[model samples]
Target: MRAPLRSRPGPGAGHHQVLFFIAECVPFAIALVVLTIELTPAHVVYTGPLLVATPALAAVTMGPKGTLAALGVAVVVSVITATHNDAWGGQQVYTNLVALFLVGAASVVTSRAVQTRRESELNQVRRIAAAAQEVLLRPVPARLGPVRAASMYLAAETGAQIGGDLYDAVQTRYGVRMIVGDVRGKGLPAVRAAAVVLGAFREAVHYEDDLVEVISHCGEALRRDAALAGAGAAGDDAFREAFVTAVVAQIQEDATVELINRGHPPPLVIGEGSARCLTPAVPLPPLGLEEFIGGPPGRLESYPFAPGDRLLLHTDGVIEARDGDNTFFDLARAMEAMRGRTRQAFLEDLRDALLEHTKGSLADDVALIVVDRVDRSDPVRGR
Candidate 1:
C-alpha cells in the first residue's frame, strides 16, 4: 500500500515553527537595522518611518504586553540614534518621536482588542465541540449486561476531539449490541454521516432483534441523510458517495458473539494468551452500498466468546498505522503483550503503543471498543 497521509504534523513541523519564531523577531530586527544605519558615518537615510513600524509589526503576533515591549525598544533606539547624529534639538527628531509614540499606543490598543476577541471565539468553539462529542459519541458504559467494556476515540487532527470514526455499545432486550465504524470522508460531511449511522445504531439496537436488521436500519438511515444533505447544496452529490464501513456485533448472555461485518476490519477475540481475527464468512459492501448486495442482509457469523475471553472491535486506523520503515503496526503482537491488564488500562497501553509505533503521527481517526466476557461466580482478576 502507498504510504498513508498523516493528519498530525511531521518532520516539516519543526521547520514551520522556526519560521514562526523568525516572524515574531521581525520587529526587533527592524530596530537593530535602524541602529546599525545610524552608526554608519555616511548615513543620510532617515530611519524614523522604519522605527515607527516596529510596534505595529509586533502586534500581529505578539499580544499587548509584547507590543509595549517592542515600543520600549523602539523608543530607546530612537533616543540613542538622535544623540549619535546630534539631532536631539531638531524639529524633525521631535516630530518623529511624537509619531512613534502615537503609533505604538494605537498598536497596543488594537492588539489587546484582537486578543480578547480571539479568546472569546476560541472558547465558543471549544464548548460547541465538547457538546457535539457528547451527543455524537456517548461513552460506552464500563459494564454492559454480561460483559465488561470500554472504548477510546483518537482523532488524528490536532485540537479535534472527535472525527469520522465512531462507535457505541448499549444493552438491549436481545443482548449487548455494539458497533465500530469509520466514515469514508472527513470534516463536516463525514461527521454528519457518522452521526447518522450512530444515531441509527443507538435507536435500532434496542428494538431490532436480528443483528442483520439492526445493520439494515443503519444503512437506510445513511441513505436518507445523504439525500437530505444533497438537496440543500446544488450540484453537490458528494454525500451520495460517502459510505461507512462498520461491524455490528451482538453478544448473548451465553458468551457467544454474532457479527455482521460491512466491509470493515474483522473483530478480534483474545484468550489464553493468543488473539485471532474473526473474519466474516459472507462479505457485504459498506453501509451506503447495500444496493450492491441485491439479496438478504449480510450473514451473521458466530464465535465462541467464552468467559475470560476478550473481544476487540476497531476501525482500520489501528491496524493500518505504519512505522518509519513503512511496516504496518503489529496490533496482534501489541495486544498479546498487553493481554492481562484491566480493560481501561489495556486500552491506554494499546493507545500508547500505537502512538509510539507511528511516532505520534496517525493517518486516520481510531475508534476502539473492548468487551470482556466474565463469569459472575469468579470475576476475571484484572478486569
Candidate 2:
C-alpha cells in the first residue's frame, strides 16, 4: 500500500523551476545590454544565437507554458537588440530581424523534438520494466489449495522494477509449497540468480519427492548458472561471491507446516492471541553455499499450523530497514502491534510501517507473504 515518493513528470517540481527561468533570462539580458552600449561593435549578431539554446534546456525542466513564455521573452529581447543596433538602415534591420526569428523558430523546433525523443525513451523503459516484472514474479494466487494467501512486493530500487528479492507459492502434491529468497548483489546479476531459484522451484516442486530434493534442484540450477557465467574471467565471481538466502515451506492438508530454511529471515506463526518467530535450531548455510555443510540436507523444521493460524514470511529488507537513528526495523515488535488484525490487514499495515520507518526510501528490495490457515470445519466460514 505504501510506495516510494517519485518525482512528478512535466516541469521541474514547484518553486524549484523559478530558478531555471531566472537563469535562462541572464544571457538575453547580457546580450541586450551589450547592444545598448554607445561604443558597441558593429558586428554583434553572435550574441543573438546564444538565446536559442535556452529553450532546449527549458524543454526538459519546464512545462509547455513555461517553455513558451521563455521563448517569447527570447524573441522580444532579440528583436529589441537588433532594432537598436540597426536603427537607421531599414534593409539591414529587416535582415537581422529575419535571422533572429529564423533562429528562434529553430530553437522551438529543437526543444519539441528533444521532448518527443525523451518521452519515447521513457515509455519504452516502462514497458520493458513491466514485462520483466511479470515474467520474473507472476501474480500469486489468492487461494492455493485450502490456504488463503495475500502477498506484497516492494522493490527498493527507484528505476528497477525487479530486484534481488523474490517470493512464489505453488500447490504441489507435497502441499502448498512456498519460497521467499534474496539473491546477493544487485541489478542484472541478482535478477539472474533470483530467476534460477524460482525457475527451479516451479519446475521441480511437483516432481521432487522430498523437500530437501527440491532444495537440491535449486542448488543445481545455481551451479548451472555459475558454469554458464564462468565462461568469462570475472564469471566465477558470481559463483563464489553470489548466493541466495531462502526459506522453503510446505503447508500440508492437515494444517501442518514444514520448513527448510537456509540462513534466511525466520517465518512468523501468528495465531489468535500469540505471535512466535520460527528460528532454526541448527541453521544451515545458504542454498548455494552447500559446501559449508558438506553433507545431506538439514532436517526440516516442523510447526503446528492449526486453523486460524497465519504464517508470515519475508526477506531481510523488512528487518534491515533503518530509521533516522540508525535503528533497524523490528519485525517482531511491528507484528505485536498488529495483535487483533487479519492476515491481509497485517501485511498492509506492515508495509505502511516499513515505509514510514525508512522515511519513504529503501536501500534494499522487499518481498513478503501472509498465508492464513482456513477453518473449514466452522460453518460460518465459507471456503
What C-alpha lDDT do the candidate models reach, one value each? 0.88, 0.75
Residue pairs in steric clash, candidate 1? none
lDDT of 2 by residue, 241-310 (tens): 6789999998887867899998899999877766789998888888788889866678788898988887
Over 4 Å off, model 2: 1-46, 56-70, 76-97, 232-241, 378-383
Structural similarity to truth (TM-score) of each candidate? 0.88, 0.80
Task: Give the winner by TM-score.
Answer: 1
TM-score between model 1 and native: 0.88
Instruction: Give the range where candidate 2 is weakest over 10 consecutive residues by summed lDDT.
Output: 1-10
The residue ranges of model 1 lying beyond 4 angstroms of the native Cα positions read 1-45, 234-238, 378-383
The residue-level lDDT of candidate 1 at 152 comes to 86
Candidate 1 residue 96 Cα shift, in angstroms, is 2.0
- Residue pairs that clash (backbone atoms under 3 angstroms), model 2: none
Angstrom error at residue 153, model 2? 0.6
